[model samples]
Target: MSTKTLGIALLGVGPGSEPHLQSLATLADSVDLRWALARSNPDKARAAVPPSTRVTADLQEILADPLVEAVIVATPAYTHLEIAAAALAAGKHTLVEKPLDVTLARAEELVGRATAHGVHLGVVLQHRFRPGAQRLKQLLDSGALGAVQSAVLQVPWWRSQEGYYAKAGRGTLARDGGGVLLTQAIHAIDLFRSLVRVRAVVASQIATTAIHTMETEDFASALLTLGNGAPGVLVATTAMYPGRAEVLELVCRHATATLEGGTLRVQYHDGRSEAVEGEAKSGSGDSIMDFSPDAHIALHRDFFGAVAEGRPPTVTGEEALATHRLIEQIVRQGKERAA
Candidate 1:
């Protein structure tokens, strides 16, 4: 392992950026958070970050700093491609928050850009770092669960009308890309895709609640065909009152596994059962900023390690693009049916 400490910069200082800051704070030995670049207000950004960090309103300042070896793009969904492209162009390893980009084309472009620049590019699908999720992946990969016959994923979350949606770009297409499916449920969606390949989908979407006036759907459901020729189901919504923990249930030939509330339960056909506990604080049912920093910290550790070792991070740009492509297909199917 390389002993070199990575000099990291944060591109956004909004609510989404808080997790990055918290994680970096705990990883001081491996990373130096050199600068924070906020386009709107530098003072507020300074206040949000630690005292040791520098604050700036200009992107050029972050790019010009040779000491800044990597950047964490925590900006809006629509801004991911532009910011990540610029960072890669500057020869800085880039770690984007999620979805890679709002669209497949832009995400692909970013992957190409990162390749051309010879820099590490990663996405923050922190759920992959969750203990329960990790164990589930291990079991599936080891064939301990046998052949997966069917799978179901549900993300029924809530965002307060007065607190979350009141923000200017909460659920708008132009800034946020999409509603619950893209923002809230994308984590679960990515986790699902990590475990299985979704070959085909038939989906329906709607804005069924008056919780917040938004341009995109607050609810979506899909029937899917997996790569193994098994059936799958996905349901994502922000309209559920009081919200609930996200769940992913996988039924295999010999065993069944269910992950909910950061806990994993597996029951074998022989009538034996096992339970594994995950992080105490589940990010479900709370504000987006309510997540614990443990997973984010793990993600950053792996990202920095990959950058130093000249290897791809856990969630590469191309890997994240696959989930985006699936999301685009689902949205397209829904639009075609509505038309």
Candidate 2:
């Protein structure tokens, strides 16, 4: 293990920034959060962190700092590419919030730039770190679950206009790129894809329901095929009132596993079964900060180790882009069918 502590900074101090802030606190030994950039509320951001840390509105200042070795892009989806590219260009090991960015092309550009700069890039798809998800992944890899013959991904979270979508650029295509799929379901989608490769989106539907006045879809549903020639159905919507824990179910040849929150319930056909739990509080409800910070802590720890040891993080930008590719196809194909 690399013993050197990483010097890190956070770009943007807003909704998505809190989880990382919480994580950095837990990872103070391996990571040092030396700076923050809060364009809207510098005072609030400053008060949240240690008095020794600097909070500013200037991106250039953070970029020019020799001590700031890495930056977490907690900015909005549309702003990810611009901010992360600058950090990568400055040779900082960059980690951006999920969905990579607002679009696939831009996500590709950002990942390519990181590669060109010879720096590390990671995405905050923390669901992959959940204990249950990790165990399920290990089982699949070891063939304990057999082949995934079918799967189901559901993120039936809830958010009201006042609680979520009403914010400026909250559900706007210009800022968020899309609604439920991009903003909320991306984590589940990333984890789902990790568990089983989605060969294609066989069919899909994307629409904005009467729940909000957003410019993007609040509901998205799709039928997908797995790489193993199986099938899966994915339904993600924030319109589900009084949201429940998201679920990922994979029906393998030998057994079926249901992952809800941090708990994984597995049942084998031969009368064997088990339920394992891990850190599982995700903002599956009205507030986006409803989740636990342990996953973020784990993510940051791995990222710092990756940076120190000259290796890829647990969820690399390139690996994240694959999720974006599937998301783009879902949105595109769904919109086409809607048209």
Q: Compose the digit string of candidate 1's lDDT tens values, residues 78-157.
A: 99998999999999999998868776788899899999998999999988888888899999999999999999999878
Clashes of each: 0, 0
Please list the Cα RMSD from the true structure of every candidate, rounded to 1 decimal place.
1.6, 1.1
Candidate 2: pairs in clash: none
The estimated TM-scores of all candidates read 0.95, 0.97
Q: Number of clashes in model 1?
A: 0
TM-score (C-alpha) between model 2 and the true structure: 0.97
- Which window of ten consecutive residues has the lowest lDDT sum in model 2? 278-287
Candidate with maximal TM-score: 2
Ten contiguous residues with the weakest lDDT in model 1: 279-288
TM-score of 1: 0.95
